[model samples]
Target: MAAEMSLVSVVLFIATGALVFFLLFLFAKRQIMRFALRSARKPHINIGADAPRELREEIQRRLTIVQSVRFEPTLLSEQVLEASKSVPNHYLHRMKALDAFTNAVDCLRSKDTTIGLRGTKQTMQLYLFTLCPSAANSSQAQIIDMFCSSYNHARHHPANFGNAELTNYMELLDKVIRMIKDNKKRRAAALYPAVETEVRLRRDCGKRESAETVRHTGKSNNLRLQARRNQPAASRPEHVEQFNMVDKSSGYSSTDHSSSGRGSVERLISPQHSFKPERDEAV
Candidate 1:
């Protein structure tokens, strides 16, 4: 279907063998993308070990919020994977994205800094993304320029950090991450209908029909064709002769021949023998 996933974490699975399609909604994709944009910008707060120990710790703690915001809580059972094996590449892509989300979250949780300090890369990005995501949807150059602009503004204006208190920041982070987790759960639930429907469709589309079943189905069709008639056998209509098949041995069809009425039949058989093609069988 060529459905784009760049707009959101909407991973679409276009069918290859049958009429079916599905999507995987990973909330992490958007955050991960914005994170990349923020990272690509040259200027960001990098509190090295030589910097004040307190400042480094604070920065590390705040980093956890960024990672948490990017976390994806989508964990499907093996059944979903097996049921959707037809699109292995897309399934694998979703798994890879999930893994990336996990790793990002882990790295951030290992941090000791609090969130929202002047000149912090992730702080401004997260706040901006949460409030205005269109800024990150631009080209790489534009996104980098936007990040640089935000960084310079925050560097001079400490209030630009959004929130700096440890408890308030954690609470706000918790709310944002909770919403993200809930959204992911809803997306995960949506997978069930697609998986179940595709599996059922595969069965209904007769992909697993046995050769015997196919033969039997064809036989039944032939029988139905045989029993069907243009008119009642007892009251056969004269016009019916136009549609009847001709005997090839006569070197002519029942129509477009000089013979009229039963003469056409006599061409295929002796006049002494009456034609009796109509038959019925107890189905």
Candidate 2:
């Protein structure tokens, strides 16, 4: 009996310990979830080094206002209506909102069409893109449908949005912004090598062309000089006058031995017979 009683007590203790441990686990899970939610809800602040201070401040201010605007838990939450009412009808605020929206869209590397879209239209476009990137290639009708549906839902069915819908959208926007910046960096990196290679190729080509030009010019100049050197001196204009004067001075005289003088002049003019061969074999 003592042994049975001890066994029962051990079982009870084990069960009690398990229940306590289960409760602690639940508590820990709850705390972890809460912390995660809080962290997600918190806004991240970053000022662009490239952006002007005023522009950065304006963006921050607008984002702050957007974060402050929270949807209610109920599906019938008039979140937009409430925000509209709470915020004054000041043109400055409207302008700020528009500016912030445009700037953020620009940051995302969006097309001119997307950037041109105003207010809720732009939001819908981005949201649709986030959901289905291929939707960008969809037909005009399909695109129109998506835009109309999003507009209708946001305007008429505020209750359909989750409590953290606005926050989620904001997060998505931030993610897209980062993605665009990363894409630009990657493209720039990829293009740098190509640009450098092209520049190097062009430089090499230019050098080759210049070298070839110089080589061709030198060859042509050398050929011209060789031609000039190979030219007959008698054909030269400078020696023509001297040849004429020699001819006039050495002209045949009837009083002298005309035949002999003519023969001598002919021999002087013709180098082929500079040395005459013996007509008779040693008389």
**Please, what is the whole-model Cα lDDT of each candidate in the order they appear?**
0.35, 0.40
Candidate 1, pairs of clashing residues: 58-113, 58-114, 59-113, 60-112, 60-113, 61-112, 61-113, 62-113, 62-114, 62-115
Q: 26-83 in candidate 2: lDDT tens per residue?
A: 9999999888877884544355546999998887788778844643221212454355
Output the number of the TM-score-best candidate: 2
Error of 2 at 10 (Å): 99
Listing every candidate in turn, what is its Cα RMSD in Å to the true structure after a full C-alpha superposition? 41.7, 44.3
lDDT of 2: 0.40
User: 92, model 2: CA deviation in Å?
Assistant: 17
- Estimate the TM-score of every prediction: 0.17, 0.21
Deviation (Å) of 148 in candidate 1? 17
* TM-score attained by model 1: 0.17
Name the runs in model 1 displaced over 4 angstroms.
1-104, 107-164, 189-283
List the candidate 2 regions with Cα displacement exceeding 4 Å.
1-83, 86-101, 106-163, 187-193, 196-283
* Predicted structure 1: clash tally: 10
